[model samples]
Target: MGAAQETRTFVVWDYLVFAGMLLSSAAIGLYYACRRTGPQTQKDFLMGGQKMTAVPVALSLTSSFMSAITILGIPTEIYRFGAIFTMYGFSYVIMVVVTSEVFLPVFYKLGITSTYEYLELRFNRFIRLCGTFLFILQTILYIGVVIYAPALALNQATGFNLWGTIIATGVICTFYSSMGGFKAVVWIHVFQVGIKIAGFLSVIIQGTVVQGGITNILNDSYHGGRLNFWDFNPNPLQRYTFWTIIIGGSITWLTIYGINPAQVQRYNACKNRFQAKLSLYINLIGCWAILTFTTLCGLVLYSRYHDCDPWTAKKISAPDQLMPYLVMDILQDFPGLPGLFVACVYSATLSTVSASVNALAAVTISDIVRPYCPSLSEKTLYWLCKVTSWLFGAICIGMAAVASLMGALLQMVLTIFGVIGGPLLGLFSLGILVPFANSVGAFVGLTTGFAIALWVGIGAQLYPPLPERSLALSLNTDGCNLTSFHLKGNWTTTKGTFSPNAFQDHSAERTALMDNWYSLSFLYFSTVGMLVTIFVGIIVSLLTGGRKQSIDGRFLLTKEDFLSNFDYFKKENHISNQQLDMIEDGEAKTSELSQPITLSTQSV
Candidate 1:
């Protein structure tokens, strides 16, 4: 038997108990899907009858916000930077205040199903389609990451194959989400998040109480250098800095809460404008709480195993696996504790999966399928939403299995999301702020923004790293070892390592330029990408000039967007077709001879 199997840390009882809990929750999800009735229209299917309460909605938001990333990625940030990651946690408050004040009201008033629909209203159809497509793509990529991390943990714990775990998780999620629709997803999310929080918090409390109180954790952390603060370097290459956090993080926050389709679906779920905004803040608060436990747990784990060589653990081939690896070591004496922690990882992952399934279904149905088939019935829409959810789930599973060949899962996911999502933010901003930005200018701005972002994202990868640093620090091997992947001896078998002979092959080999330039610098991926996007977009917008007619102040309800909602504004006034017509309304004469579209006389 494999050493993982031989170790058998979890007893039969533990397996049975955990299985029961998971199955029961799954049963609840199935029930919700089976019983779901009434309106399955775009509003209800995507938004949850538009009567969802603030609390569950908030919880659901938090649940979606956290994925395998929150559980595994943050600790890594702490492990890499010590206490500096605290900056990331506190950044949430800033995200909430700014997001609540600037963007919510416009979204609420516009009655948008997909956030990018506003881009179409503000910009041209190409930008709208571009923004919507990227949102879907980014969300799918993130969902794949969410699935991959948990599957990795389970693979290590149960001696299961990693690919098998990925497929299993994807299939199970698809079954429920495909059948249950949004109702199934939200209910499951509520429960899954609740379990995740309880399990994570309990683990933290136990680790703290057992390890001589929270002070010990802090003291250990301080000595270990996890509490690092203030990287005052003005270099743009640095990854974390006050400026980057405020600017880039704020942009990310805006993309998520202000314009991302995932949160939009949640807002659309609420019955009232107040409830929708209520849920937004409530979610911010919940994320605040999640950060607390996850951070504490991270410190505790690090303090306990500060002396351990994480890289040496055969199971710790990836930095993200350290949490689960530590959980195994931490619970060596307590039979069920490992199970509990594993359960927590599963819960967080599942909540994320359910939420993604829900969001993707909404986007696929409302943005893609609905536009094509306006005559489809509610029941038909319901089935289509469910089917699309399953389709997306399958895509995510396939991507998760292939993620191994990509860049670091964490950095790759964020960079892709940032590059694509950054333009969407510009689109939303233009929609609400630039009254004179006709579809032409909007389109020009959007194309320029995206082209700029694309250049930074793709071009940056091709750019040679610091040529000087390549000579200073480099590692090369003539051959591979059977350590990280192959388990030659047993679970107890020592992990594989680079043989000393490998370096003999090329001690003089030049290092990659990335190693030279990639450090705690401000010139990171997001930094370069954001600057390119905003700069190009603004310039393009200016050069293209303005439009006729003043946009209504009511439509640009910056702060009021969220504080109030479009739901109470009456159905007829939902879209400003008449108001929009007032500007281009008279362009009939100009467009009469120019029916061919080209940033001129758009949709008159």
Candidate 2:
């Protein structure tokens, strides 16, 4: 065991493989930087000249949100909780469908840069500013989590310096994102996603072979209670049940795919509406593929250590470290494979952070900065955009240092999204779907929803659910060879300490109001905030004499637009290729205008 531990440290081959990925990413940024024909315009820098195709954009969409959080956290979630985590795949399918049908058409037709621009068109500047603030907050905090997750995992498994990895990731991502702009970010996503998949596959294929085969893995997991797919418990307080996984998961992801600025920017960059929609469908496949791979990787981890659970055996301190530890434990004999997996994890980080940085720059320029400084030159605005990317990168690095103190990367991220993203999603949905939603309603609804959600989220964090409520499956340490591991006196190993029925007897002891509030599953935070916002926004609007002013039909998704999107083969109903060209051309000609021109009155 000691000899094997010695061999697990990163070697020269590992460093080389990791460095190669960084250099390749940097080179792609440089290529895009040098390839510019002249002074880059706002459209070129922020929108990729509105000429991006379906496939790379689709891949970029996939990579943008697939961050190290999913790579590291999802597997650990399954390992500890059960296979019920895989139920999120159904949520992804729902998210993509709602995004394509409901949200995409309104944004696509308006031909805008920042998505918050729609809020202003539909309501008022105050609403736009509020929406912009929420998005920026949500993204910056989420980037902090993304940057911190893999660094902590690698630090635990390989003795890598944690702060050093965080700084390196932030700096490299900032450099390329600031230099190459949106084109560079999208292409870098395309490049890194391949490496990310390769890294995931290496572990899955190698581990599956080592664990006998798929059947053996399934059998082992099934017997151990890890294959818990049919948990139909209706209690919202219970985590990972079918209702929470499907309903809560769908709303949580919709905040990202449907309304988040990071994703909306990607849709705005496509060549046309059809390609944008196609990119989303392709992204659906990519998301499901990665979800399956990570879920299987969790099962593989269980099969390898089912008899001697690492957390129970004191091999690692936290669940997030399991994947990295497994990689080092099993792949050490294969020289560069461990390094490839590390590269893969960081690749996910780079893709996510770069996309956030780029999206941040766009919103700062379009939503916040430009509205006040409409007279700023195009040249000045372009430079400001790049500088904003750098500024946000620095902020994310500082926040990453803070994220180390937060517990459980996956829940922390989703909680951040729910607390902020839910209200933003509600605000947008209210505007796009409700014709009578006024500025007063928008402002009051957003603030009230945000306050309540923050209270619930913070309360839940301060007083986490009891261990008995969200019990881990049974684990055994009987197979552990204590003689091979130097143990601390305080560390004790027990069999069957955690099981399905172990904690049920203690559930009735908690009855306080705050305790009940805190016990609500983290999955429902988004739903809570969103429902409050929509319900409150409607009530406020009706009370305030809703919508006294006329609204542009282009800003709302009406019945005709909703039904026409389903008529897939209707040539006239779709945005014609010629019309798309005109829209792009009009955007270029009107680039200097304070507000973008509404090119076509027709629905996308």
**Best candidate, lDDT-wise?**
2
lDDT of 2 by residue, 84-190 (tens): 99888899999998999899978876778888888888887888888998898888889988998788778767767778999999999999999998999999999
lDDT of each: 0.61, 0.82
The stretch of ten residues in a row with the least summed lDDT in candidate 1 is 470-479
**Per-prediction TM-score to the true structure, in the order listed:** 0.81, 0.91
Candidate 2 structure lDDT: 0.82
The regions of model 2 sitting more than 4 angstroms off are 1-7, 482-511, 565-604
TM-score, model 1 to reference = 0.81
Residue 596 C-alpha lDDT in model 2 = 36
Task: Give me the runs in candidate 1 sitting further than 4 Å from their true place.
Answer: 1-9, 37-39, 312-315, 454-531, 549-555, 558-604
